[model samples]
Target: MAGLKIFGSDPENQPKPRQRFADDVVGRFRAGHTIDDRPASLDEWRITTGDPDVAARVYELFGGEEPQEGAAKGEDNIEVFTAADSVAIIIESAKSLRQRMVLWGRSGKPIYVSDGEFILDENGHPTEERDPDADLTFQERKEKKDIGAVPDIDLFFRLADDPDLGIFLFKTGSWGLAYELARDDVQGALEQAEGPVKAVLALEPVSFKAKSGPRKGQTVSYTKSSLTLKGAA
Candidate 1:
């Protein structure tokens, strides 16, 4: 908590970096994360918006090359244009998003519900003949599974509507913020996010490796590296 507070203040006091939290939902959306529900002396909005290495990796995963010179020149800091509210977050990477959805669907924690759709005939109208390509199965067809854009969209929606905590929503534009692997705190967060959409984080760990030799069992290491978050979603 103290770390987050310190982090929040560090960014605010500086000569507004090229990337500051502008009062735009796009900015806010760009710098998206769950609202800090925990009590603290001061509330600091967590942001994750920079890191060339992370940007390169995320870009690679999302089907784009790293930005060239001056790519993020003006958009140094995020601009939160809209107030906190329910919003649909669209992750642009089709392959990566699909792979993550499969991961979350298997987790069984943040139950992923499939949305039902109508069976249309060749004329593009609902017909007695069921469309073989419909997403909904017979069982799901009876109930609209509340399906939306992509898996991340549904996951973010669930996070925002979490009963135990509340989170704001944001859509991905251009390229989302990237985090480097820094400390155990961030790693732990990633493990927890195994269930659904994870927060936008950036960590730059000097070194990271499994504690035990690579085996046929789950393994992990520990660290206490400092974490620096740049911005939201």
Candidate 2:
């Protein structure tokens, strides 16, 4: 019931298309009831979905429109996003992002991402297939003709006060270690969140300062706040 559970959309056309990559990030958004950045205020977690095939589901959730610039009226072009409009729409809307487990993928043409639905049990119940190491398992997704595993899901956002930074990303550190403890906390927190929640955040570099090898002295990103919501007290 915890550790980064993302719900995908299926009812109809919705939220993608601009071609975003892991390194494209500039900043992040946090879940806060107000425009504050301190840690105690931040609550909800902005992490990626646990589904490996989350890539395909992403396109399904937020589909872009086909170009209609040169076409005749009512040409029915696939309503696409020339930019990161869906993220903008969600932020501007009064809807709770919790409605669908959001996992950001790309901004351009939707490509092939593996179907990560859970394999069923003998009695047709979902098996224990969804559990993948939060810091190790990678999605079987890729951009068109692009090599390597899919980049982790990230969000497009900018500080409400620092508009100078433009739109950046609150990248769900899919393979990073520092977020291990936080991911589960996030999974549990999101489950309890409700209503139209929104907020601004200040990213802080945090360290657990592991006393041993490998990760000793390593630094990972940490968002310092969460938005306002019922029961998030």
Candidate 3:
């Protein structure tokens, strides 16, 4: 693994970063085309191909670095390329895609379920298995000991330029647009990856017909991040 220095030790013992949402995020763009190089059906606003103003704003925010350019051209750069949906940067270091559960209440507030302590395998790697000491907060709150738990995936990230930003969580799991994260390609990258996976992340707009919902027959549009992983770090 001499050339595979992409991973590091645990991040918990290190410092945390901020989450890029709303104004904090530079911007998300729909894939101009599919991975095969075909034209995409992108709407107007979500398009981040290259508007002069948008480029200017990006340059201003990033100083020397720009979107047209990939990212820091340093040794730490992993040069990753994901054949999955599409994507960007995240702050991490030898961490698991640690999953938790969530239970919704009548008030519609989300209650994050305890993942308990992750049970590591013989190799010292994390497993979905948990300790029997699971927190009972969800049971107490729902007033039901047998409440069902919805699985959740929490991904934390921060921009290189914005180090002061507190670690933000990108929560998702087997749901609509969020489901893309679970794809084999993207999930594989997360599984193989180790440290702060920073790269040029882009969000491509996607439009499709709803399958089994009230709007089953209606057309809906949403955005998906373009995930890429090149060679090893």
Instruction: Estimate candidate 2's alpha-carbon lDDT, on a 0 to 1 scale.
Output: 0.32
Give the best candidate by TM-score.
3
Model 2: worst 10 consecutive residues (lDDT sum): 93-102
Q: Count the backbone clashes (under 3 Å) in each candidate.
A: 31, 25, 24
lDDT for each residue of candidate 2 in 128-194, tens digit (9 for 90 to 100): 5542222333333322114333323343443333333334444332333223323444334544454
For all candidates in order, the CA lDDT equals: 0.29, 0.32, 0.44
Cα RMSD, model 1: 19.0
lDDT comparing candidate 3 with the true structure? 0.44
* Global local distance difference test of model 1: 0.29
In what order do the candidates fall by lDDT, top score first? 3, 2, 1
- The count of backbone overlaps in candidate 1 is 31
Judge candidate 3 at residue 176 and give its lDDT. 35
Q: How many clashing pairs in candidate 2?
A: 25
